[model samples]
Target: MGIVVALWAAILGALAVAKYRKEAEAERTRIRDMRVVYELQLSREIAARRRHEMTVESRIRRELESESQADTAEQVAALRHELASMRGHIEYAISNTADPRRELTAKPHGDVRELVVSDNAVTDADPGRTEQQHDQDVVDAEFETEYQPSAHAKTR
Candidate 1:
């Protein structure tokens, strides 16, 4: 009878060990599945964040390019205006002479007033202002009065 009781006790101990091993395996599997789910969520979140950052960077780049283009356009417009002012000055100088090409190329020998239209010689005989100063003043006045903004310039 004692031997029989000992054999029964060993059998019950073996069954208990097997049941514990099965439960442990099931717990391990549950933990592995949970870890996989968390990793997937983390990866999705990281991808979303990266996409947002890229979108923001793209927007900033576009804005910078637009500003650069606007600056370039403004500079072009200013250059055009300066060129127009210079053209008006040249036209004023040319119109005052009897022979535009000859007077422009020739040197003044006898009378400086005859070769070039001097403000001091023609209308304002201001003794204070020299011939060069009068010429500069005329140019300044003509630039102020005759400088018409081009269509592109007016829009700016």
Candidate 2:
């Protein structure tokens, strides 16, 4: 009877040790899984924050670029308007002004014709009184004078 009771006591002690070891190993596994989940959550949060920052930076850059383009366009338009106004002012100045010398020199004189001789005449009065000489005499007149040569004659 003593031998049987001792064997039963030994078997009960072995079963209790196995149950305690199994429970401890299960607790350790649960702690490891929780740590893994916590790390995954932290990584997700970091990635989300980086994405948001990038989006904000991109939007800011686009806005600044658009504003700069608008400013450039406006300046170009203003310069074009100024150039058009200058052209108009120049045209008006050319149209409205008149030269008094041109008007005074345009009148014809009848007395100068009496001194001119035809090309066929051979007058011995003065060698310089011929038609060619007379034409040369009027060459020194004002450029705007009525006796000025035509455009075709000036080319020759």
The candidate scoring highest on lDDT is 1
* lDDT for residue 72 in candidate 2, whole number 0-100: 95
State candidate 2's TM-score: 0.45
Question: Model 2 over residues 54-155: C-alpha lDDT tens digits?
Answer: 999999999999999999999999987776665455444434434211111111475321222223433334865666665454444333223456565686
81-142: candidate 1 lDDT, tens digit per residue: 87676566556666765431233322356532223443333434466776677565545443
lDDT by candidate, in order shown: 0.69, 0.63
TM-scores, one per candidate: 0.59, 0.45
lDDT of 1: 0.69
Q: Which ten residues in a row have the lowest lDDT in candidate 1?
A: 98-107
Model 1 lDDT, residue 53, Cα: 100
Q: Which stretches of candidate 1 lie over 4 Å from their true place?
A: 99-156
Give the C-alpha miss distance for residue 148 in model 2, angstroms. Answer: 35
